[model samples]
Target chain A: MPKIVDHEERRAEIVAATMRVIERLGLDGATVREIAQEAGLSRSVLAHYFTNKAQILVTAHQTAFAAVRDRIAAQRAEIGDPVELLRVALEEAVPVDARRMLEANIDVAFWEFARHDPELRAIRLDSHLQAVEMWESMARDVQAAGSARDGIDVEAFGVETQLVIDGTSLQAVLFPEAMPPERQLAVVATHLRRVLRQ
Target chain B: MPKIVDHEERRAEIVAATMRVIERLGLDGATVREIAQEAGLSRSVLAHYFTNKAQILVTAHQTAFAAVRDRIAAQRAEIGDPVELLRVALEEAVPVDARRMLEANIDVAFWEFARHDPELRAIRLDSHLQAVEMWESMARDVQAAGSARDGIDVEAFGVETQLVIDGTSLQAVLFPEAMPPERQLAVVATHLRRVLRQ
Candidate 1:
């Protein structure tokens, strides 16, 4: 039989390497040379999959998020209580573990780029808006289940929760010593109670 | 006197130009070449003022923070109430105005770099620790004045406040349309009340 190659798997490998390179070296230092070295592929071979650094970063972001998305999906399936699921759903977004620490680092690294590039900004903004909408849906489910107070605006709840979550992740990535995973979790949990009471 | 230039003043001007460029093009895009163009000077002239891009970034961060530091100090001097001062102190760190928006952009742009470099990481960490300490001191004053409930962990209060403050700035810089000055103020104000009651 002739040799068979899986294009998608190779691309996924390159994206994972890009993320690892980004995690080890900040986005500023994640050169194509470095990413190719991290991926154990020649520059020419890497280009066969990704044309440039920008494309690789975009793919890395999309793929890195899938981990958190899958975790949240699993939580939604296994948990029975809306409030409890909300907590776990949020925990997945935060940097409470090694996997998430990489994700959060990758997430923040992209923000400055988004500020400069319109395409990246659109992708980032769409992702955050979707995240907020998802949280709002969860908040609505919580309220409908009688866990949250009446008259709460689920949209506002979603926005604030997303802000706090982002804030917590930023804090953890920048100052991991002071903002341990436990403390990050506490901040989100406290936010849940404060918003739920409103 | 022979022709003389104030070295400190010239350095300050370069730092300002660095901020403008970083705010517009982001740290990744804010090459020394772009910064020189923004400053209306040749790269050689820029080299006379600073050694490299790394030094420019460090100086820009330090100087940009001075604006916030000055605002917080003025608020402290003007306000007689502790809780109110706490609110304004937190506000100075957030990106509520054009000036602070620039500061916020510069601030978040540094996070990924700090993650990769040890010296940068230490500088960033120390600044945050100092900020948290500043908040804790302010919280103590609030508690002593009886504005806040007794027995709250003032240290934890400071840490969480700083996290939210940073989180708000990160959000506003990335998505200004969603987090306006009014809404940012509301988030900080709400956090103040929630922590105080605890």
Candidate 2:
């Protein structure tokens, strides 16, 4: 019998290696050779999984987003309160721990890289739209459930809420000590409370 | 007679060249040769002005910040209302024009670059603190003038305001067409009005 090749597993392994290389050497320094070395695989083997460095980067980004999405989904599965669900979902986006710190570093590098790459830019914009939609849907659901205030423009509120989360995440990554996990959560809570009905 | 050399003018010229190179070719691509070529100066001449690429990057950042500061000061000199002044100051920070777009590009690059360089990291942290302090002072002034609400935590309020501005600025730069100047200003105005007492 022929041996079974787990293509998905192999691809994920390569992406995991790519993340490690990026964290250690930034985008500029994350050369193919360095990534292969970090993965303990030959450059040719790595190339079999990814066409080039840029492909790996895009995959890395997708992997990161998927991981966060999974975590949020898992949390949502357990929560029943609409307000608490939204709060936890937003708070999960903040970089307050080791996993998030790594994600933020990769995100920062990707933003800089995306400035010149059209494909990467598209991926970024698409991801942003998805995030905005997620928040808008949540806000609408909560409002319908009477937990959130009526008369609030759900779309604008969603945009502003995303702005605060993205902004707070950036600050948290840039100044971890100044913006601890608790502080980040507090900012999100403050904004949500301000908009939610008493 | 000795040649009267304007060191500051020459440095400014090099920084301008660096910015152009950064705009055309990202931070990694804006090498010594490319910058020298862009400025119409030889490599040796460029070397005479700055020691390395890092120094040039630092100078470029300072130039960008100074330009924004000067613009804000000019606008402030003509405005009398404290609320209006605060609005104008915060609005000026947004990248609503070509010049600001270039600054944003450089800023995005610098932020990623600063992740590893301790000296650059220090500069970034210091600049952030300065921005926070400036916003805090402006918030206090506006609140004291009875334009803003009382019993509000000015420090936390200022930090949140800065977060919104910085976050919105990032989004505007990333998606200019989606987030036009008018939209950017509207978002900031909305946040300010929400916090201010009617």
Candidate 3:
């Protein structure tokens, strides 16, 4: 029998290598040659998998979002507390560990790149809308459960909470020592507690 | 009589021209040639004022920061109410207008560039510290005036406020339709009221 190739696995491997290259050299330096070398694959193989660098970048971005989404879903399933669910979701959004830090670095690059690329911009906007909706739903759920303070606008609170999370995550990446995991958690918790009733 | 040259004025002009180029074509596209064309000067003439593109970028970043600082100072002079001053300061930090939108664009580029360049990174770090200090002072002043809520940690509040400003500003740039100036101001105001005694 002939050996079967896992095309999905190969594509994932390429994306992982691309991320590593981006982390090391930034988006500007993440050339096809560099990525191929990092993946231990030839240029031809890379081409066979990805149409271009931008496609690879988009895939990488999607992958990062999916990872966070999956983590949030898993936590939501395991944790019955609405407050804990909100906390976990917010914490996962921040760059508290190596995985999240890497995601943040890629995100920074994509933000710059997306400024000019319409396709990437569309993807970013869509992803943002989805995340905001997710947060809004979660906030509503928490409020209904009586964990969040009454009379607070759930939609606005959700957006503001996300703004704080994004801002704190960016700061964490820019100033790691100043924004440690504990500090990030504290900042999120503080903001959440202030909005939510004790 | 020999024609006198104002070195500082010329440098500022070059920085302004560079910003135009950056706005038209992202940092990656804003090559030396493009900037020279945008400034209506020869490459040699451009070189006479700045060492390289990176130097010009750094100057542009500084100019953006100074513009915000000047605006805040002017507003502070005009407004006597402490709460109003704090509100205006926070509002100015968001990218509500075209000038701020341009600054936000340059900022996005600098953030990515800073990750690779230590000099740029140092400048970013220093600027952040200065802004945080400014906010902390403003928050303390407001608190002392008894307008702000008592018992709030001025330093943490200042830092968190800045984070919200930055995060909201970025979101404004990315999703202007979603986050209009009025919305941005409202979000900031909501967060401020939550932290301060209304």
Candidate 4:
């Protein structure tokens, strides 16, 4: 049988290439032709993967978010305790490398686009929802395990924790040296520990 | 002799008009002609006010930042207490109304432009410096009042506090219902109170 290319893998490759193009050239300069050239593919082939430039942008954003989601999931599994899980989730959000830098770049770009693009807007909203769900799950499990304080509002705490994560990401991106990863982790740990209650 | 226009006042008016243009149209859509139209002046007249589009964008960003600075200074004068001053600064960053909405929109738009525009990048860096100064001032006052612990790392705490403020702004802008003004204020109050070793 002839070799079959993995569609999902190919799509992700193209998406990663799109991000490289965006970071190399600002989003406005990241033209479809430029992206295709960077991806080492024909324009028709790139279009075959994503219908248009907007779709490509959207895919790149979703791809980046999926990576973040996977990182968090992996971190959650690695940390046995809920308190530590929350810590890991937050630490993951801090800007640590070029990938994270690109992620932050694409994230703010998506937010600006959300003001105008409905599809991007929907994706942005969904990503927040996913974040909320992930935190709520962790909160519930922690509460059930009696690791969290009795009578504490799990949902509210979850939202607050998410805020810290979201906020930390912005600081890390804009003021990386100012809000170092260690500092961000410490703050997250302190906040989560306090909220956990005895 | 004919009356002469106040240069500073005229410049402020032009920057204000630039903000209006930004709010109506996205950053990319705000052209020199459009800004001139919004300012109710001829293109040449607007040119006399700001040399080019980049100049107008940076000045408008600086103007928006100045409003926040003025707010902080005014609030600091009224509050006297460091924690209270910090709270007021947090409130100023939130999306309180159409005017604030205009300011926030321009603020976020500037980040994307900063990714590419050297002038905008410098303005962003300066804004970060201003934030650090604001926090450092608050920290010193707090320590002097004996509300903060002795030997407090004012610079570190200041950076963290600014992260909270900036992060809260991002969350409030992204998720208004959950991280609204009141909720944000409460979260901030809790964080501020936690950091103080009183």
On TM-score, the leading prediction is: 3
Q: List the residue pairs that clash in candidate 4.
A: none
Instruction: After the best TM-score superposition of candidate 2, give how far the Cα of residue A15 lies from its true spot, in angstroms.
Output: 4.1
Q: How high a TM-score does candidate 2 get?
A: 0.87
User: Per-residue error at A43 for model 2, in Å?
Assistant: 3.7
lDDT of 1 by residue, A59-164 (tens): 7778777777777888898998999999888878888998788788778767756877889988888888888888999999899888897567788778888888
Model 3 residue A49 distance off true place after TM-score fit, in angstroms: 1.4
lDDT per residue (tens digit) for residues A9-51 in model 3: 7777888888788778766787888988999998997888776
Model 2: runs farther than 4 Å from truth?
A: A1-5, A13-42, B1-5, B16-41
Lowest lDDT 10-mer window, candidate 1 chain B? B1-10
Identify the superior model by lDDT, candidate 1 or candidate 4.
1
Winner on DockQ (2 vs 3): 3
- Score residue B119 of candidate 3 by CA lDDT: 91
lDDT of 3 by residue, B139-178 (tens): 8888888888767788887778878887887888777877
* Decoy 3 TM-score against native: 0.89
Model 4, span A59-86: residue lDDT tens: 7778788998999888877878877787
Error of 2 at B145 (Å): 0.8
Score residue A119 of candidate 2 by CA lDDT: 86
For residues A10-122, write the lDDT of model 2, one tens digit per residue.
76677888888877776667788988888888989888877776776777778788888898889878998878888888878888787787777667667766777888989
**Native-contact fraction for each model?**
0.83, 0.61, 0.69, 0.42
What are the per-residue Cα lDDT tens digits for candidate 4 across B40-152? 88998887877776676688788888888898888887986787776667667666666776677677667656766766776787798788787887878878878886566
Question: Candidate 3 chain A: minimum summed lDDT over ten consecutive residues — where?
Answer: A1-10
Model 4, runs deviating above 4 Å: A1-13, A16-31, A34-40, A149-153, B1-6, B19-30, B149-153
